[model samples]
Target chain A: GGIITQTPKFLIGQEGQKLTLKCQQNFNHDTMYWYRQDSGKGLRLIYYSITENDLQKGDLSEGYDASREKKSSFSLTVTSAQKNEMAVFLCASSMDNTGQLYFGEGSKLTVL
Target chain B: SQWGEENLQALSIQEGEDVTMNCSYKTYTTVVQWYRQKSGKGPALIILIRSNEREKRSGRLRATLDTSSQSSSLSITGTLATDTAVYFCATDSNTGYQNFYFGKGTSLTVIP
Candidate 1:
């Protein structure tokens, strides 16, 4: 069984700083996704990639950017961190976008 | 717009008791997925129910879908403390191939 690994599980950033979170999956799935979850909130899609070098924006992609440089990795960037806020960013991959999704542990970001 | 709405009520149940959570969606969806997320952990898909299939089960978990009502339910029997988590229901029915939409989840606490 392959694993999806997210880097720097805990991240601290200053207000207005640009923060990047990285995810790597060895499942070799064709689709990669980025989502953000606030406390007591559901997951909101930020961005997703259907293949290598592809990008698609989601409902919450306004303040974020994503890149799929390779098939096995997807990364998300927060353009400007909000002060005194915290959110968990999750990375997921799927063999098909409409099928079962596998998720990475997550990256917790705290903006100071 | 395809969106899901899960009951926001927080449930507390004793271990080994049965619990059920309900979710309603708007729009015609091809597939529905149920997921669980433990504290500080990423969400994982527990079951996927299609429009045609009314019910599916995996171990102690059972899922039921009602296409006419555009609603679904997840039932867990003989619950364990480890089963305490937030459960979310997501849909894959989009406007001309759109991204999945999720709703705020139901939080369940299995008390010992």
Candidate 2:
């Protein structure tokens, strides 16, 4: 079995501050994704990468940037934090685009 | 607008009771995946029903897909406390990219 690990389980940032979240997976999967989950608002895709060094934006990618520097790791950056913005960011990987996805525990962000 | 936005439905039921959750998507998709998320954790896929398959079951969980209605439903029988969580439905559009969309989710509380 493979596991996906996300660093900094919790984050607190000030308004306009930049924050980064990291994810790693040992599944050797080809697809990685970052999603944001807000209370009562379901999960929204921020970005996804199909392969190393590849990036694709989702519907809610306006304030986020993602990187797939290596095959096993994916990272997300919040360009500028907003006050009272609190959400959980999830990282997931799949063997292929159409296959089942394996996800990390998540990184919770709270902007003050 | 989100593609797979589940009805903002929250249900509280006693153990041993049966429950069902529904979701509708705005676009055409070839696969619908159901996921369960516990508090402070990322979502986990419970069932993946394809366009060709109308119904799928796993242990005490059952999922039904309707292409004509662009909707899906998940049913749990004889629920346990462990079943308390937020349930989400995701769709794989096969849009020449790995674009999987997730709904907001339905929160279910199984009371003991």
Candidate 3:
């Protein structure tokens, strides 16, 4: 069995500060995704990488950037943290675009 | 925008009772996936139904899809308190480059 690990389970940032979340999957999946989850709002896709060095924007990608430096590692960056913002950032990987996804526990972000 | 509207926003039921959640999408999809998210964890795929298949079952969970109506339903029998979580329905709508679009989700609380 493979696992998806996300770093810094809890993160605190100041308003306007930039934050980065890292993810690594041992499943060797070809597609990786970053999603922001807010309570009662469901999960919103921020960015996804179909392969190494490939990036695709989702509906909620305006304030975020993503990088896929290697097949097993994908990272997301928050351009500017919003004051009092709190949400969970999830990292998920799929074997392909049409397969099941395996997700990390998540990285909780709190902006003060 | 391709996401479906879930039937119930939230539900509370006894541990041993049966429960069902419904969702209806607005666009054509090749597949629909049901995901469950427990508190402090990322969502996990529980069941998936394809356009050609009308029904699929796994253990105590059953999923039904109606392509003509663009709707799907998930049923769980003899629920346990551990089943309490938020359920989301996702569709492979092929919207943009992103493959899956998810609904707001149905929050279920199984009272033990």
Candidate 4:
């Protein structure tokens, strides 16, 4: 019955600006992931970490960076925002790579 | 290209009707997970069907997996308004790494 919390539910950034989103989970899971979802689209993986201080890139990781500083927290950074770029970023954790995942509410980003 | 891609089907049905959503994947996967996402929220796991299992059910929801076709389907019966949401199918490929890919999603609106 643990929860995943994501900070700054909504974000507005200017073009070329850098933005960071943070996530925390109390499930003591070993795998964490960050995904981006555009309107009317599916979730695209940006990055994932199997353990603390580990990082792996996904198909859509060109402009994003991720960090798993601790076992309970994972963060994502947008290197440079693009105008009219609006998407929802989700953070998820799993007990293991092949198990069910628990997700946070999400952080919505709007670039102006 | 995305590993798992939903049909992008948007379905509108009455409360008492039944609906089914489909997803297709391009690569080998060990498991397929169905998720439901309400507005302004992260996706929630509804069912997880493994490659070894063909069908799985939970209450009013049912999921079927076909490894030969590399596809899966989710069915909801006697839907309620609360069931209105976007549905996604995620594939977990134990490719010596954690590779979980999500489909685009199917948006379902249960009309009262």
Candidate 5:
């Protein structure tokens, strides 16, 4: 079975600081996505890439930037962290836009 | 409750009881997927039902969809303490690009 791995399971940042999270999937899926999950809230899409170097913005993409450096890797950057902002960032990959997705454990971010 | 209308819901039940969770969407979707997320983890797809199919079953989990009502329900029979988690319903919509949207989720606590 393939696994999706996310780096730095825990992250801490200050207000207005920039933070980056990385993800890698060995499933060789064509579509990759980044989602943010707040406490007791649903997963909101931040960005998605259908192929290498392709980026699509989702409803909550205002303060984030994403990069699909390759088919196996996708990264998300928080332009400016907000104080007291705590959330989990998830990385997922699917065979296509309309298929089952495999997700990583997640990267928890704490902004102080 | 409705994903497009309100916040997440919470449900508590005994371990051996049967429980059901409901979700409603506002837009047109080709598929509705049910995902389970444990504490400190990303969501994982448990059951999925397409728009054309009214019901789908997998092991102890069952999912039903109603296109006319834009709603879906997920039922788990004879639940166990391990089943305690947040359950989310996700929908795939085509808006120039295919995007998957997730509901706020139902936090289920299976008390043993």
Candidate 6:
């Protein structure tokens, strides 16, 4: 069994601040994704990486940047925070894009 | 418009009762996936139903898909307090292994 780990489980930021979230997985999966969920709302895909040095944009990728430095790690950066934005950022990994997904605990972001 | 956006809404249900969540996508999909998410946690895949299959089951969860209508439904039987969470329907387009697009998700609360 493998685990996907997300760093800094909780984040507190101000409006217009830049926040970075990190994710690491030991599954050695080729695909990784970043999604954001607001309270009582559905998740929106931000970015996905197929392999090392690869990146793909999803519907909500406009304000976020992602990097796949290596096969085991993927990172997401919120270019500018918005006030009253309290959402959870989730990291996921899968052997392939259409297979079952393994998710990290998630990083909660609170913008004041 | 890759996946029909109609299946992307949330739902609420009562405990000990049965509730069904439905989804519809615009594109041709070979596989359909169902996921559950609790408060403060990442989503977890519950069941995966394929194109040729009409129904799939796992414990108290049942999922049904109709290719002609481009629709899928998830039904939870004998709901419990632990079943209070959001359910997301994901579809993998016939394009193959490109990625999954998720719906808005249904939020169910099994009141005790």
Find the candidate with the highest TM-score and give its number: 2
- Tens digit of per-residue lDDT, candidate 4, span A26-112: 999999999998887888889999999999998789988899999999999999998655799999999965568788999999898
A1-112: candidate 3 lDDT, tens digit per residue: 9999999899999999999999999997899999888878767788998999999998889888899999999999989999645799989999854568788999999998
Which is superior by lDDT, 4 or 5?
A: 4
Q: Score candidate 5 by TM-score against the native.
A: 0.95
Q: Identify the runs in model 6 with alpha carbons over 4 angstroms from their true place.
A: A84-86, B2-14, B93-96
Error of 4 at B5 (Å): 1.4
**In candidate 3, how many Å is residue B94 off?**
2.2
Candidate 2's DockQ is 0.75
The estimated TM-scores of all candidates read: 0.95, 0.96, 0.95, 0.96, 0.95, 0.90
Say which prediction, candidate 1 or candidate 3, comes out ahead on lDDT: 3
Q: Which residue pairs in candidate 2 have backbone atoms (N, alpha carbon, C) closer than 3 angstroms, thus clashing? A: A42-B104
User: By the lDDT metric, which is better: model 1 or model 2?
Assistant: 2
Candidate 2, residues B5-111, lDDT tens digits: the string is: 78777999999999999989988888899999998888899999988999999999999999999999999999999999999998865565377888888999999
Total clashes in model 3, counting residue pairs 3 or more apart in sequence or in different chains: 0
Docking class of 6: medium
For model 4, how does the per-residue alpha-carbon lDDT over B1-112 read when each residue is reduced to its tens digit? 6666887888999999999899999888888899999988889999999899999999999999999999999999999999999999998755644667888899999999
Pairs in steric clash, model 5: none
Candidate 5's residue-wise lDDT over A1-112, tens digit each?
8999998899999989999999999998999999998887788889999999999998889999999999999999999999655799999999864568788999999998
Candidate models: Cα lDDT each: 0.87, 0.89, 0.88, 0.89, 0.88, 0.85
Which ten residues in a row are the worst by lDDT in model 1 chain B?
Answer: B92-101
RMSD to the hidden true structure, all candidates: 1.6, 1.2, 1.5, 1.3, 1.9, 2.2
**Chain B TM, per prediction:** 0.94, 0.94, 0.93, 0.94, 0.91, 0.90
Candidate 5 ranges with C-alpha deviation above 4 Å: B1-7
C-alpha lDDT (0 to 100) for residue B65 of candidate 6 = 90
Query: Residue A73: error of model 2 in Å?
Result: 0.4
